[model samples]
Target: MTGGAGYIGSHVVRAFQQAGIPPVVLDDLSSGHRGFVPADVPFVHGSILDVPLVARTLAEHDVTGVVHLAGFKYAGVSVDRPLHTYEQNVTGTANLLTAMADQGVEAIVFSSSAAVYGTPDVDLVTEATATTPESPYGESKLIGEWLLRDQGRATGLRHTSLRYFNVVGSGTPDLYDTSPHNLFPLVLDALTQGRTPRINGTDYPTPDGTCVRDYIHVADLADAHVAAARALGEGRTLEPVYNLGSGDGVSVRQIMTAMADATGIAFEPDVAPPRPGDPARIVASGELAARDLGWRMTHTLADMVSSAWEARRAH
Candidate 1:
């Protein structure tokens, strides 16, 4: 699995391990911590862009498939560094595909993002939703999907992409989301550093006057990835993409409340001005994934917050 040492990737690695599958990890450790990988798992410290290295690792492990989660993932930052995003997401994906083809690894489960939908005009996003990505990061992910589709046509590569919104919580206390830009880590960092957790744009059109988003637990998302990989291995016909989302949504205000309760913090969050281009709400229907990939909201809002808080504190 590429990037198996990172946040979501590490959780997926553990899921694979729990299923009696030992995975070899290839990570550059850019934003990933080496400790996130288990001491028993074979770890290769390298980037997917290193085509020779990836091919060698695949051959060494006799890998049958790939779980790709490595990339430049910050949507906001991608706007200012479009070239860097393409290098990491687009070009890096192309290199991984090349290595896979070279090593005869014909299956992959791509860790895509809901950013491909951008600001959807519909009430609920689905597999058929029009893709009009607003940032370089989203565009790169969309292009990565295109790469897989094109490769499938040419080389019969079996592939599927999992699109998701905010991923929260940890499956175990030993792992946590450490991205400086992600919500759970940001809020937890603020609280840990003796600063107030602030909520941006609390006057949206939602019931609680904050932006609403689909927040799925990382463990549930990891399960879906494993299921997708198994489906590919079994030659099951699967959709090209699946959205791992909450049918309903949770507001930022709700998240703040949960954080306070979970952390035993008494202070209310400070309301700040809305970030530019911040949508009032973005939620999707996970019905397709539920039907095909065993996707479901296995964790409640409180579960998401409390589990994430526990992991962050342990870290």
Candidate 2:
């Protein structure tokens, strides 16, 4: 699995292990942590852009499939680092595909993002929703999916892209979202440091006047990857893309309330002006994934908040 040491990737790696499918991790440790990988798991420290390296790793491990999660993932930062983002996400994905083809590794599960929809006008996004990415990060993810689609046609590669919503919480106390830009880490960090956690915007046309987003548990998200991999391995025809979402929306205010209750920090969040291109609401329907991959939200808002808090405090 490429980027198997990342926050989401690490959890996916663990899921694969629990399913009795041994995984080999290839990570550059750019945004991922070396410690996230298990001690016994095979770890290769390298970038996926190195086609030869990837091919060599696949052959060495006799890897039958790939779980790709490595890329430049910051949507806001990608605006300033467009070239960097394209090189890492687009070029890197192309290289990974080349390596996979060279090694005859026919199956792959891509870690895509809901950002491909940008700010949709609908209340619920699905696989059929039009893709109108507004950031380089989102554009790169869409391009990655395109790469897989084109490659599948050309090489008969079995592939599926999982479009993730806002993934949060911890599968275990040792694994947590460490992204500096993520809301959970930011909120938890501020409270731990005796500062007020600030909400980006609170004037959106929602019930709480804050932006609403689909939040799914990381553990649940990881299980979906395993399911997708298993389906492909069993020669089952799967959808090209599936949204790993909860078909529900959680506002920023609700998150703040959850954080306060979870951490015993009762202070209200500070408000800030809306960021550019910030979507008011971007929920999604996971009906397709549920039917195929048994995708479901096993964790509640309280579970997400408390688990993240416990993991953050642990580290």
Candidate 3:
């Protein structure tokens, strides 16, 4: 697994352990914490761009597949540093594929994003919808997917790119995200820290005027990761992509209200203008994954928020 030390990747690692499937983790510790990973699990501290190190790590682990999660993920950051985003996301992905192919590792489950959809006209975006990535970060993920799909076709590398929406609600309080990228943690931290939780906008067409996004529990998404890998490993057909989401949209105010109700804390939202290129709403349809992987979501909107708040307090 790459980027296994980040918020989503670390949870994926724990889910692998829960399923009795151990994975080798590769992280540069650029934004990820080393203490998040268990000591018994073998971890290589190196960038994916390091070709020699990647090749060596694959051979040492006997890795036949990967959960590719390492990359710069912030939409705003990508905008601020397009070149850096392209280099880390695009070049790193190329090197990962090369190292994997070199070692004859033919299966991969890529950690894609809902950002690929951009601002869809439809409320619930399915896998069949045409991709129109809005930002550099989204563009980088699209490029990564294109590379994965094309490479898999040429090399018989069975692959699945799970297009994930908002991945919130950390199961492990010890490993909550400190990064300023993710929305849920950012809001929770701002509120808990006594700083005002800023709402991007209050003038969207949505009912609450705040941008609405599909929030899937990290654990649900993590389970789908293993299922995708297993399906590819079991010689399943080359359907290499699937949308993974709750199919339920939650606005910013709705989330804040829910957390406030649950925690008995008044959420003082600081309404600010939406950032440029901010999509009004992004909701996804995950029927394909549900049908094929038998995946079901366990958390509700309240659960997702309350759990994050609980985890935050614990930390």
> What are the runs in model 3 whose C-alpha is more than 4 Å off?
274-277
Residue 301's lDDT within candidate 2 is 95
Quick one: RMSD of model 3? 1.6
The residue-by-residue lDDT of candidate 3 on 43-79, one tens digit each, is 9999999988998999999997899999998987788
Q: Each model's TM-score?
A: 0.98, 0.98, 0.95
Off by over 4 Å in 1: none
Candidate that scores best on lDDT: 2
After TM-score superposition, the amount by which residue 178's alpha carbon in candidate 3 deviates from its true location, in angstroms, is: 1.5
C-alpha lDDT (0 to 100) for residue 165 of candidate 3: 81
Q: Which consecutive 10 residues in model 2 have the weakest lDDT in total?
A: 290-299
Clash-forming residue pairs, model 2: none
What CA root-mean-square deviation does each model show from the true structure?
Answer: 0.9, 0.9, 1.6
Global lDDT of each model?
0.93, 0.94, 0.86
